[model samples]
Target chain A: MASRAAVKTVIMVAAVALAAATGLAGAGARAADADAVRRGEYLFNAAGCLGCHTDEKGGGKPLAGGRALATPFGTFYPPNITPDPEHGIGRWSDADFIRAFREGRAPDGSYLYPAFPYPSYTRMTDRDLLDLKAYLFSREPVAAANRPHDLSMPFSWRFLLAGWQWLYFDTRGPRPDDPAKPPEWNRGRYVVDALGHCGECHTPRTTFGGMEADRYLAGNPKGPNGDKVPNITPQPRFGIGGWTPGDITLLLETGLTPEGDVVGNAMAEVVRNSTSKLTADDRAAVAAYLQSLPPIGPPP
Target chain B: MDSRVVNALAAGSVAAFLYLGFGGLGAAATDGDPAALVKQREQTMKSMGGGLQTIAKFVKGEAGSAADVQAAVAAITEASSKDPAVVFPQGTAIGTADSDAKPELWQNWPKAVEYWNGLKPATAKLTEAANAGDRAQIAQALQGVSKACANCHEDFRQKKQ
Candidate 1:
């Protein structure tokens, strides 16, 4: 009887231990998911997702997407990106999310418009894209139907977008690190090129609306809403060459120019939504990357 | 010639003189010429910018004393205290040379007024900070002022073309 009782005690102890171990493993997984969500929130701000997705002027719900983006082609309303299964991306599989950014193809395999800035987002790594998706999914599942784009004729047809994508979209995978450059520079490059998508407005576009890569960051004469985007290259006269890295960081953080004037208009929205939310190190990284660019003179 | 005809000719000459002399002045007085109003507003804005720069210099310890900061804050306060309606009268929207004011300012007049009114508290905080001579508080208060400026400028000011 004593031996049987002792065996029963040993089995009970083993069962309790196994239960605790399983509990700890579950907790660890939850913590990792939480961490990914946090990282994704930061990436969302960096990518300026909220500004385009939320119609603050019209009192639209955040990420529910009724905001109208006026383009030369026509007005494009960004779709709902929240986690609602019916209207948002809640039903999207991980592969679907990755494909949207990587190939600019929807789950239905329809071509996304270039106005989505996928050209820049396509430079994001699969991991970063997934992290962003994780963050987006964590938001409240808002239930708002997406407003359709108001394009005319050929531009409205999704089939034409395939031709547009073929002409302009670079099929290159995530931007690789340069062995020669420091890690900080590479990180800066990622934030500026991949997440910020600054060139989508700052770079001049061709007649067909594809970005002019040769004149990168040279400033667009006719940007969104007919605003003239300024040159951000390191040119002494035309660009930000006179600005120090600290100046750039300060501008990103506060929208205050070195000359003591605060920036206004659309760039102010960028500063408020995106750059201001970046970590101090990331802001400095943006400055470093911008200052290192080859300065291009004004278009002739 | 008859005396009546001579009097009639004299009245006509006087009327022509008055029209030539005060016609432009009368029009300016009533509706505020768009060009002149834009030029005046731009100057006022530039002066405000200069005052902020002086305060910024003090905050950075690059130059200027507390007294300079006080004076700068006072100038900014004085300039910003004016009724925005007078400063931004109708017909002073963008398209006037060097005027960055967007037509939205007039279109959304009440919102613009609210944004302009928002500057009051920011300037007040700046004034208090300047008086206290606390560098940290002054810098923080200055940020509030910048934000106030940006709030209106974001919707009402056009970017450099």
Candidate 2:
């Protein structure tokens, strides 16, 4: 009886060992893909791709773009960015995807509208972009058809964006983090300026849709959909100057305000989808950086 | 009577008065006056806003009034617990002036109810945190309440007039 039990135990041990060895071999091959997808998921949220890419009215399918972004210029429907070969970016080369984000150029060599936010995204690092592409490619592809923009006359011309790009698009990537600042502050700056692109909506723009660098993050009076984006600068009267760092952090995480006012409209979407997903430390850093900004009044 | 007991009795009466003043608006809402209903909800929201600010002042150490904090939390709990459906019935969205409620609020009634429903838990948490007298917990709970308010307004409330 002892000899029979020993034989059974030996057989079970051998079977387990064989399964582990086989799994290890496959795990090594899949590990890199897994890492890239994880990194991509982080970048996708950080870059706020879902806000514009998803069709909000149609239940917001991930990356199956159809969100109509309204601007003073026109209402532009974001294209399908899913991995579907027919209706999405599946057939495009890595270079094509990179160029679209970095140079605002489509695979067919046509210029994209400024509404796509490539100008701000162009500041992202190459590695980040690559990881983002990997993440996007990993998503379940949906075959949603592309919708065209409703633009007035000349604005519909894709070639015209080239002239717009020449005026506003910076060839240089993001400016390096200030060495004088702490790593946390730098991270906050990177998230705000490069990843979150908070200035895109907060800062007032020039007549031709170029960001007015002088009025950076001071709150745009002529915001999207004609709503006034409130001043976020630390100005005591009009901006968030009176708020504590915790207040800002809470606002980012939960879209709540000291006045018991919840952040509304576009910012609500931002908190729900983008900034809320950030780590607590990262959100705190963002608050710290925002607090440190020179307190400026509303844009003239 | 013991002073603590007296204080409790006074607080309870004040709370009851405040509740009746605001809760009466809820009753007015059902009287078939959409305008009155809108006005009542707006007043309730304003009270919630005031309560939130009062607590924020305490959290920031701008105010050290324990009684104020207690009163604020009580008011917020009261205001938040009211069913937004009762306050924002059909046709309360009329008039192009003053009211910022969107017509889509009625069109998507179930979604509206969901938004209103989300408020209670946050306020309940706030009541616990405030009772505990922990500043950090209170601050966190305050955020919970604020987020709930902001989320609903984002979808249902119209742009400020």
Candidate 3:
């Protein structure tokens, strides 16, 4: 009888220990998920998702898009990215989300417009993209419907985007770290090129709207809102070679130039929303990355 | 009368008439040529920028004295205290080679006035801090002034292309 009692006690102890182990594992998973969301929030700001996704001027809900992006082609109203089942991206699976950034293809197998900036986003690592998705999914979903793009004629034809993508899209996976460079430099490149997507505006575009690969960050004569985006290359005359890393960091922090003048317009918005939100280390990294670039002069 | 004399008189009368019509309008607007007013306002803004630069130098410990900081504060205050309507008159909103003022400044006149008026309080705080000779306060106040400059420029000034 005592042996049977001992066996029952052993079974109860085993069950209790299993329950405890399971509970600990669940807590660990929750903590990891939280960390991912936090990291994703940082990436969201760096990627400038909020500025384009939300219509702050129109008093629309955050991530419930209605922002009008005026381009040479036509006005593009960014769709709602919030997690509402009816209107937003609530029903998107992990593969759907990944494919959206990686292939610039929607869950419905339709090609997304370049106006969504998936070309730059395509360079982001899978882990970073997943983390960003986690953060986005954690947000409060709104029932606001996505607005249709106001493109004219052939531009409105979604199928035609396949041709454009075929011509411009690199279809390459995440950018790999250069073994030759320091970790900081690699981080800077990832942030500036992939997450920040500075080239989308700073780099001049071809007649086909593809970024001119030869003249990266040289400057855009016709940028969004008809503003002439300045060259950020390290050129002494035309670019920011004269600026020290501290000057760049200060500009990112407060929009104040070394000349004591504050930046204005679209850049001002970038300063306020994106760069300002970055950690000091990240800002310094951006400075280092920019300072290291080959100095490209203005187009002759 | 000789044709030469008639031509001279006619030219003189036309010059007088043109001066009276346009000059009266200019006088009614801001008591001087609009271009000259733009130039003056530009100079005032430059002076403010120079003053801020001086303060920045002092903050960085690169150069300048406490007295210099006070002087810079004074200059910024004086420049910012000017009546916006007088300095930023309607005719000066055109984008010329000399003027950086955007047409939106006049389009949203009330908001422009508000931003211009905001500079006064910001500069006044800087003046107070500079007079105190507290470096930290002065730096903080300088941020306020910079923000005020940015607020106005964000909407009114044409960005460098």
Chain A: TM-score in each candidate? 0.95, 0.88, 0.95
Ranking by DockQ, best first? 1, 2, 3
Q: Which stretches of candidate 2 lie over 4 Å from their true place?
A: A1-26, B1-39, B54-71, B89-97, B128-144
Q: Candidate 1: misplaced stretches above 4 Å?
A: A1-11, B1-31, B56-67, B132-135
| Clash count, predicted structure 1 | 0
Q: Which is better, 1 or 2, measured by DockQ?
A: 1
Better of 1 and 3 by TM-score: 1
RMSD of each: 7.9, 8.7, 9.2
Instruction: TM-score winner between 2 and 3, please give it.
Output: 3
Query: How do the residues A1-300 of candidate 2 rate in per-residue lDDT, one tens digit apiece?
Result: 999999999999999999999899789868977898898898889788898888876796878886788887789888889899999999989889889888989999999887878878888888888889888888899988888899886887778888989998886876787999999998888788788888889888998899887777888888877767877878899899999887887678877677766678888888878888898888988887887887779545
RMSD (CA, angstroms), candidate 3? 9.2
Candidate 1 structure quality by residue, lDDT tens digits, A40-66: 999999999998888988998889995
What is candidate 1's CAPRI-style docking category based on DockQ?
Answer: acceptable
Model 2 chain A is weakest, by summed lDDT over 10 consecutive residues, at: A291-300
Of the true interface contacts, each candidate retains a share of 0.52, 0.63, 0.40
Error of 3 at A70 (Å): 0.9
Model 2 interface CAPRI class: acceptable
Residue pairs with backbone atoms closer than 3 Å in model 3 (clashes): none
Docking quality (DockQ) for each candidate? 0.39, 0.38, 0.33
